[model samples]
Target: MKKKDLLKLPSVSEVLLEINDNKYHNDKYIKYIIKDEIAAFRSQAKQGSLQLDRNQIIQSILLKITKLSTASIKPVINATGIILHTGLGRAPVGKKIISKVSKRLSGYVNLELNLETGKRGQRQEHISALISSITGAEDAMVVNNNAAAVLLSLNELAEGKDVIVSRGQLVEIGGSFRIPDMITKSGCKLVEVGTTNRTHISDYEKAISSNTGLILWVHTSNYIISGFTKQVKIDELVELGRKKRIPVMSDLGCGEILDLSNKGIPTNMIVHDVIKSGSSITTFSGDKLLGGPQCGIIAGKRSLIKRIKVNPIARTVRSDKWTISLLEETLRSLRMDSINDNLTLSLMVTTRKELEKRANKLLSVIPTKLRSNHNISIQETFVEAGSGTLPGATFDSIAFKISSKKYTPAKLSDKFRNAQNPVVGYIKGNNYYIDFKSIISSQEKLLLSSIVEVLG
Candidate 1:
């Protein structure tokens, strides 16, 4: 608070002189950082919360510069067993896929140039035929994400008209995006036709009118209503739409292509079946179950797809070259019956026995010093198929339960997270646990190194 104390603060030039690294030598940015640090120091000193020390202030400014220069989107190991974790970038594109795509995209290719005629081309042509072949639809297209696909479809087919949906199926996806809000934004009126727990086909029949533009059927992929539930099947709705001369649209939030029932994973209406069931248009996500880059796939009748393609909003929400190339490769892998090559599908179907073997291998590698210092053992845990793909289903998994005499569970978890290559884990019942279900075989060594570096 005294003039003399204010004079003790370091000058901006004094702080800049300490940043000798070439990367941090940008004088303008460094000066800004120094000024911001000085403002905070003045405020704290005024509140009697901090002392005005020149050396400490200079060191703090240097640290801020170092942090600012580092990359924020580096990779982290996912030890949390939740496959398709939204926080960890939903579905991870496989390294092999990335390499192949990189080779083609690193330089320019035929993105919008027609090789046959040497004329302009459409980007959607890259994935449209592939999606059609896999899903058995007349045509298909890709957008930036599922929400964009839904908005484009509604704006084209149901704008200034009634969009009928069941009350039970009105759901909210990640980031607080609700179905009703999307409908309103698309310039359509949302008409709720059934009860929350029970929706009869009669309710849909009564709700249909001349103003009905489209019949919307939403799959509650995130959650399930257990008892006393009744909703019309897609076939029945399709029949009704045929009679009423209206189009039926199905929003399968998670686009499942193959039947995973034999693998103990529950089966939803796959994309192929939805189109085969006579739905005019069916939309789903490419990132969730398809194990590809984030995008929205719209597959249905040729006429409807043609109309959707011409919409002005389609141009605004179209997928870039990277998404098209990556998704095209992913779908080709699926068509070739190479499921294991897809990382997301591989993690989802990894057996508990395999996980146990990995967990045991990890347990045997812990340094003897750490083994003596920390109490670590293998335990059984349960995790789900995250990102609203498979609801009410839990898969058995193996995890390493750890306890320390000097550190609490929360403290150990924090240490793991702050390691050079972060290992993300969870804490439960006074112990920190790292599940092996989500850890691919290649990441095992890095996981061990992180453990030794933290507990050693």
Candidate 2:
């Protein structure tokens, strides 16, 4: 910890001179990184853990700079098979949809222009009609995400009033976003009715008063309570709202625009059905079950939508041109009954037989050298429609069960994850598994190459 030892550390100018790469030419930024590194070295020296090698310190600084310069949001293969995995981006837009959107948006075409009138127009106009047609709502609007949609609805309709919600339906979604918190943020009071396991219509009736701004019915999309659980339905709430002359809002967390029961997926209330149930306003996520880009869709009575659009917060959370364009095409695909062209739905509806074929194909292509060195076999597994869309429902899937005496499961998984194109898999018991359910066909070659590179 002596001053003489600290002076051995390289100066900022010395380190900058060593960094010859032109891409790291931001001298001010590089100097800041160098100063931060030097401070850390001094701290380590005081703690008696400093490595005195000047070359090593400079290399460490270079590595930090390189890491900071690289983009952290690059795409990685989702090998864990959790379709709609939140960490991997909940919904995957189809290539055709992306191609069509790129053609229109790569340049510009009527983002907010009334070409005929030769004046400025609203961006929501691009997708509002499409959403109205698909969902049967009198009118609709798009926002940045579902949370914002719910926030905007509550703020516009129930600010300074009580928003009644069932205790059972007051669930927390990803990143600790809770229903009660959202209501409070929207300038409304959260009124909890009935018990966590049971909420009767009478509970709602007793809670309503002159101060009740809106009756909120939240869908427990992420979790379920069964056996002795009772909750009010949308239609029942709608009837009560009509009798009481109060607006009822339903937050269908993962909104379904199509009936997926035929695809072996569980059925939920499609947006049209929710609108038909007579709710005043309904908010749902565009990314989850809708198989669209990340956005929140608010569809309901035309009058209510009009008020929501006028709220200043609406502009703050509004969807941009790119989101509108992508969502419009996604809705069109749904309208045309082209499920195969929707990546999220296609992946959800991928048959067990198809997954088996994909698994076998991958196994067949593994080099003989890798096969001899590792125990690679196909095994049956299950993956969920993640992001809280279908709780308690798991689809049948197949995975490559890889085991090796030379490498532990953790080591094998790490190696795959750090490859040129990272492959993410799960380790269970003593083996590492890569489920083929979520891996698209186009990624098969890359997956094969990663496996060979790691095991060879």
Candidate 3:
């Protein structure tokens, strides 16, 4: 198009009239998209780079507007083998909750209404029984996340007092969230006891004073210290707390109900045992190893949990109806022994043989020319349960390695990520690898199509 012809371009009103009549793109935001496109085209036309005619411009503008309106957050395929990959929304929630929680999302729920008496009820009642059953706690409540659980617990129990925590246990997890920071934010004075390398029970004994309010025990689930490191056991901490008449709260970052080690996946605590250790209150993540929604669970003695529930901060950090609905069902699934059907545990505990089979299936489906262009082979890979769960624990996995003559590994990874639904993987040396540990069998065809689209 010529610069002179640019003046004759359709106005924003004209374009809106043309496309706004369509039912699908009739949203109010289409005007902004149209204006932006016109401005961009005007710039291109002035620069003598405009190649398309008016019809082509309208089509392109319509496509852009439609995409902008319809596509907001595109879901991605997880080939990274980080089971609880935080970047991809952490643990992938199962669709089983869709039908179960649909009504709660779209309509009114008895979230805090007691149907029997038609009176006010507790939202915590929804998952309290389930959590108590699974963790062997006298009572339970949930918040937005584990951090909130810790924050609320400390603010309620230890605010304006001292919280004695082991220096070794004052660790940071993903997103730079530190234990010390949370304690300080809760208005509790942090009494750091013992060395980072070695924190004995005596450290707590010495830290306890007249102002001591709570003994906080943190689980270093995200990272590990090697060689000679000693941290006080939860049971011992609980005993000390009992003697001192102070509560012991264990922040088991990622809580697990099942003993994954028996299933060949290494994990720190069997959640019930942590509660059984006699901690007055225990907090953990719902999304990490428990394979539930993104929420924080606090479970332990009924009295302590009741106090935490009534804390004012509890209202701010409480889970919504949808979360309760999903969490209730997730806990139910765990009790039903059908948890392997859930995505998180399935991926975490997938055997090497299973991944090898998936890799072979993918290998068989690659087109001949595409395989030739990219040096493709199956390789042994290591998959980690991510998001601070089971730190330093790796499971054997199978991956497809693609080293292309036409594209570098980084370039290939970028191309894959730029697809409609991003496919995430890692690059080592000159090859791009997609670990099969986290990829569901149902996603194999989509993964294959994405590779063909990007590389073929």
Estimated TM-score per prediction? 0.95, 0.94, 0.92
C-alpha RMSD (angstroms) for model 3: 2.8
lDDT for model 2 comes to: 0.90
* Winner of 1 and 3 under lDDT: 1
For residues 1-456, write the lDDT of model 1, one tens digit per residue: 566556667888788778876776566776887899888887777666666477887888788988776777877889888878889888877899999999999888999999999999999899999999999999999999999999999999999999999999999998999999999999999999989999988999999988999999999989999898888899999999999999999999889998877776678778999999999999999999899999999999999999999999999999999999999999988843457878888887888988999888888889877877888889989998889987888888999888888789888989999898899988888988899888877888999999998898
Ranking by TM-score: 1, 2, 3
Query: How many residue pairs in model 2 have overlapping backbones?
Result: 0
User: Over the stretch 1-456, how does candidate 2's per-residue lDDT look in tens digits?
Assistant: 666657668888888888867766567777888899899998987777886678888899988988766677876889899879988988988889999999988786898899989999988888889888888899999999999999999999999999999999899998999999999999999999999999999999999999999999999998989999899899999999999999999999999889878778888778789889998999999999899999999999999999999999998998888898899998888843458889988998898899999889779879877876788999999888899987888899999998887799999989999887789999999999999889988988998889988888
**lDDT for model 3:** 0.86
Candidates 1 and 3 compared: the better one by TM-score is: 1
Q: Candidate 3 on 279-388: residue-level lDDT in tens?
A: 89999999988888899999999988888888999999999988898889878777434566467887777789988987887898899889888988899988788888
- In terms of lDDT, which candidate is strongest? 2
Candidate 2 error regions (>4 Å): 2-7, 20-30, 46-48
Lowest summed lDDT across 10 adjacent residues in model 3 is found at 334-343
| Best-matching candidate per TM-score | 1
Better of 1 and 2 by TM-score: 1
Comparison by TM-score, 2 against 3, better one = 2
